[model samples]
Target: MKHLNIGLFGFGNVGRGLYDVLKRINSDNVTIKRICVRNIEKDRGIKAEFTDNPDDIFNDRDINLVVEVIDDAEAAYDIVKRALKSRIPVVSGNKKMLGHHILELIDLQEQYNTALLYDASACGSIPVIRNLEEYYDNDLLCSVKGILNGSSNFILSKIFNEKMGYKEALKLAQDLGFAESNPTLDIDGWDSLYKLIIITMHAFGVYVAPEQIFTYGISTMNDADIRFAEEKDRRIKLVAHVEKIDDRLIMCVIPQLISRNKYIYSVEDEFNGVVIKGLFYDKQFMFGRGAGGHPTGSAVLSDITACAYNYRYEYKKRNDSVLPRYTTEHTFRVYFRYKSAEQRNLLNFLKVREQYTSDEYNYIVGDVTIANLKAHQEELRTPDCFVAAYPFD
Candidate 1:
């Protein structure tokens, strides 16, 4: 049997969980050779060789596997790039790194004859990526969308269910380790956007630049927005979505109003759910714990074990003759809330569905192009404004 000596990065939640899980599995041939951390003196609750130097793992040719669970995207990219260049298989949970540098990383894998598996990056424990790559590879995926970020979802759930304020719910999510080290990533929709970019590769076999997609977070959402949702018999959720409209694909991550009858309406806390629509299979829903140590660790472990057989993503869709073109020509009916008329004037609404005004709150429900939203994303993210999909259907 070939021994799989692993070099691990970042001994935080996911890292520690991977360690505990590896120990539980009792894979005698699989052993952690060394752990790399920013601070080596921090007590990690296990007796293992730890180092701050990246070369410790890079120089040790005996280490055939690298597991990177670090929070830093640029740092993780460097580590992953080096490992692949050395012909080492890597199992990563860094969505930000993969979202930004996946094309280059995949190229590296092909060049060096190594594998990169990151099932833990999106929809933790859901196995969505593998299913997209294998099970749905041949199927015509019409759309893939749902609650992709658990931290943001947790905050939304708390606000709607417990009547907790957004800031309170967000702080609670951070305290429970559901939110990322930089809460801005989760609350501001960048985390979900990053994961969405990764999923688009597997789902559509096309690489879409993150900048092209408009993302609006829940940080600016106020009680008026929540009350509006409540009055309309809907719940607010930070949703990441992509879909095909003829030959074009539209994608975005933003706070959306979900009706009660939807599959994802009940998804709460640190849980994730995805709805996939295909031409043949129709609609499929997948639900699982989306964040935290143990659940994500289980996902990482699956990827690690798959390395035993040297499995890698085939990216079959990329090789497809015809691929869907990502476009911003799509228009969606959305509810925009703002304190001042000037803020409301920022968006060019194609059609007005409804309008409400008051001293405390003012909003407009109207049709707005994806391009218009992307153009005014900075203004939309201001403290006085919040936007959500207002699909009445």
Candidate 2:
């Protein structure tokens, strides 16, 4: 086995967790040569070489691996690009970065003959990417749907099970390190959207840009929405779904009403659950802690270990002769709650199956196309509006 010298980026929670796990495992063949952080003097609480200069890691010929856990997507892209250009293997947990730049990065890796493994990028330690790359590469994959964000899931669990207010649950998650101080990415559903983009590439060999998918989060949810879900015997989960519909693929990330029979209905707290459906294999569920430091750090460690043996993702699905095309022409069953009839009219519902109005609440259950949702997504994010997608054929 070739000895590994790692250059780490971002000494935040996940980066620190990686450091601690490496120490605990005591892998004699691996060592962290340098850690790149924005603030070198921020008192990281452990002894290690730290640098504010990117070249400190890039210029060092001995640094054979780059593990990036940074929050800045652009900077992370630059670092990973430079490393792959230099023929160094990289393990990244930056889903936002990878989701945006994966097509180019894949080309670069092949051009320079290096590896970029990102099992840590999606669903923490569940190894979703690796499974899609290896296990389901030859299977007739029909759909992938799941809870992809643990911070949001944690908040939802608190709201549904503990009767906590959304803001209170969000604060608790942030205090426990499950969420960021400014959690627009998680709560507004961008985090899940980015993960879905990455999963789309692996599951169906297509690159769907983030903006193409319609995303609705739980930021606008309230007690009325919760009561409605309870009355229907359902739980609201932020679900990212990508399904191959004939020759085309349809994708979306939205707050969904999950019935009792679904795998993700009971996946509470910081845990994530993914249900992969294939033609022959049917549906397979993978569940684990989807956020925080240690679980993600373990995933990064697994990639680093694979690097020791010269393992890399083949991305076999991408090599298929006919790749699935992405489309937004499909429609979905939805439940929309708003403060006024004007807000309800904003969504171009194809047909209304149910409508309710009371002194305190007004909502409509109907069918709406993905295109209409994408066009009116910002309106749905308003304070008085909440929308949840219902399961429909």
As a whole number from 0 to 100, the lDDT of residue 162 in candidate 1 is 90
> Residues 24-115, candidate 1, lDDT per residue (tens digit)?
88888789999999998888778998999999999997898999999999999999999999888999999999988999998999999999
**278 Cα displacement, candidate 2 (Å):** 1.0
Most accurate candidate by TM-score: 1
TM-score of each: 0.98, 0.97
Q: What TM-score does candidate 2 get on C-alpha atoms?
A: 0.97
Off by over 4 Å in 2: none
Per-residue accuracy of model 2 over 1-393 as CA lDDT, tens digit each? 899999999888789889989999999999999999998879877889999999999999899899898888999999999999989899999999988899999999899999999988999989999888777853489999999999999999999999988889998888877785459899999999999999888887788888889988888888899999999999999999999988888999999999998889999999999999988889999999999889989989999999889998888888899887888999989999988878878889899999999888799999999888888988789878989998852
